[model samples]
Target: MAIAKGYAATDASKPLTPFTFERREPNADDVVIDIKFAGICHSDIHTVRNEWKNAVYPIVPGHEIAGIVSAVGSAVTRFKAGDRVGVGCFVDSCVGCAARDLDREQYMPGLVGTYNDFEADGKTRTQGGYSDSIVVKEGYVMSIPDNLPLDASAPLLCAGITLYSPLRHWNAGPGKKVAIVGMGGLGHMGVKLGAAMGADITVLSQSLSKKEDGLKLGAKEYYATSDEETFKKLAGTFDLIICTVSAEIDWNAYLGLLKVDGAFVVVGIPENAIPVHAFSLVPGRKSISGSMIGSIKETQEMLDFCGKHNIVSEIETINIQQVNEAYERVLKSDVRYRFVIDIASLAA
Candidate 1:
């Protein structure tokens, strides 16, 4: 067993604090990573506070991870010592299962999350990137491009891929009008990626405060969602709408903005269910769909796509000691975009 240092919530409603735990020695297919940075995700707050029923206690919450390869099992061939790499929301899945694809192992009956869940072995609870080190299968890890800094690249594992998958799936490209709801972590990435894909990008934000930033990030248009007139003007204007806000939204109002046969893709997981009436979709043949993080194959494709376009998340770097405070700011939407933890500060 290898001793690892991390921060963990001793129980629900408790702040994360310093903790020590053990990691299994690397198997032949595993690659040991020395974690460099971790991103603070809103879902981390929900799970730590027990807002999400499936959350397990003493959980170490983090999925956006970036690091360097420190050691590789003898059988590992994809990476070597000193390689830059990253791990996302999951670590391992059943590779032999039917649902498993070349890019993702099937985890329908049982999926091992990056944290707060048990591994296939059943005895060990999987910890996450909140720690100083991790051992993941080579197949599940991705190569971080040398052009992108590791800190900003961390959130790409989650927020970046979350938006990219839907954009690609729905074919947001040249001549398509794409509207991204919310201007925070995920939305900002949506704007950049959507624009990079040759779409006419717009930002639908609650206020005009982020309008300038949104435009700078590739949005060709910005509108305040709080304004009644804004909705009237955009009615039947968009080909695709990506909502990244976790709060309950006026679904019908947003749906009204979609053009005929358009789609509204949801990536946020709201705490409570919001009622969706059938009328919202029936009239224009509008569609509402949801997406999880991308498949491992898709994630790699996203990274390559971003790398090719020189795209990366806009982040505010915080020290490890400020992690709890960062959580508070995230709740208030006080972050400029995303918060990335500098693990070097953990040594302090």
Candidate 2:
């Protein structure tokens, strides 16, 4: 076993503070990474605050992780010391099979979260990347291309993969009109990726506050969702509409924006259940569905695609101690885009 240092929220109401913990020693198939940067995902905030009402106290909340391989156990062959890598939302799965490059583990019955959940053992809780280091099986790690910087590339583990999976699944490509709702962390990445795929990209935001940023990020058009005319003008316009906002919205109205036989895919989790009128989908044969993050294979594909296209998140780097302030800013949607914690602050 190895001792680890990190920041954790003792309970829902308490802010995160420095804490000490343990990591399982590297097994022959495991790789130990010296965490470099950890992105502050909105999901991390929700879990720590017990907003989902299933949080485990003293939880270290982070899943978008980028790091350098510090050590590899004897059987590890995929990585060695000093390789750039990333770990996304999970560590292990329920299949009872442990091997390098586990297949589609995210959908398996025993899927384990990177934090606030149990490992495959159902006893030893799995912590996250808001720490000095992480020990994961070699299969769960991803290689970061040299072109992508550690800090900005960190969010791709969660935010990047989250959007990529849906876009690719829906075949957002040349000739496809795609609309991304909201302009926050997930929305911004969706714009970049959707545009890169040659889809005609549009951004539907509540306000025009980030319109310039949206256009610069590759959105062909940006609309203020607040304008009733905006929705009316764009009705039956998009082939695919991806709603990235976590807040409850008029889903039926958004569904009306899709063309006949078009699809509406949701990646964000709204606290409240969405009510959809039958007419929303009956007339056009439009489909409304949800997609989780990508499989490990697809995540690697997303990374490679991003690497080739010079895609990385727009992020603000902060010292680890500033996480509490960052969290508050994130909730207020005050961040320019994303916040990445510089793990060196923890080392200090």
Candidate 3:
């Protein structure tokens, strides 16, 4: 076993605190990483608080990880010591399944999440990247591009791939009018990637609060969803709408904004279910779909795409000790985008 240190929520109601743990020693295909940064995701809060009902106690919640390899197993060939790498939402899955080959490991029969889930052995709980070190199979780790800063690149592992997978699946690109709902971590990434893919980008946020930031992030238009006229104006105007907001919204109203055969892709998991009318999809042949984070292969492709396009997430770096406060700010939507914890602080 390898000694590891991280911040963990010991119980549902408590704040995350320094906790010491152990990790399995490297297997023949494992790569050991000294974590540098771990992005705090909204789902981290939900899972820690037991809002998702899948919460596992003593949870070290983090998936958006960026670090440098400190060692590699004897059979590893994809990476070596001192190489930049990252691990995302998933750490293991049924790789032999056809779903895995299609980059649909999330749908695999037994997918292992980075944290709060059990491993294949069915007893060892999988800890995540919110730690000083992690050992993952080489197939699950991705090479981070030299052009991207490890800190800012951390969120790309989760939020970045979350948006990229859907956009790529929905074929959001040139001649497409893409509307990103919300202006936070996931939405901002959607805006950037959509625009980069040559789609005309529109930000449909709660209000004009982050309008300027949205436009600066590559949105061609920004509309306040609070204004009734805003919905009227954009009705039947978008080829795709990506809803990144986790709160319950008027789903039917947003559906009304879609053009014929347009899709509304949901990336955020709201605490409460929002009712959707069949008529919403019936009219205009629209569809509402949901996407999870990408598979390992596609996540690597997303990193390569972001690197090629000079794309990286906008982030606020916080020390590991500030994680609790960061969660509060995240709930208030006070963060400009994503918050990444500098893991070196954990060692301190």
Return the TM-score for each candidate structure. 0.97, 0.97, 0.97
Clashing pairs in 1: 103-297
Expressed as tens digits, the lDDT of each residue in 72-151 for candidate 3 is 99999999999999999888888678343667886677788999998878998889878999988888899999999999
Q: Which residue runs does candidate 3 get wrong by more than 4 Å?
A: 98-100
Q: Pick the candidate with the highest lDDT.
A: 2
Comparing candidate 1 with candidate 2, which one achieves the higher lDDT? Answer: 2
lDDT of 3 at 12: 93
Worst 10 residues of 3 by lDDT: 98-107
Provide the overall lDDT of each model, using Cα atoms, as 2-decimal numbers.
0.90, 0.92, 0.91
Off by over 4 Å in 1: 98-100, 103-107
lDDT of 1 by residue, 1-348 (tens): 899898999887778998889988899999999999999888888888888788777887789999999999999999999999999998877756525455434224456799998888998889998899999988789998888889999999999999998999899999999999999999999999999999999999999999999999999999999999989999999999999997887888999999999999989987678677789899889999988888888888888888899999999999888999999999899998999999888888
Q: How does candidate 2 score on lDDT? A: 0.92
What RMSD value applies to candidate 1?
1.4
Tell me the lDDT of model 3 at 251. Answer: 93
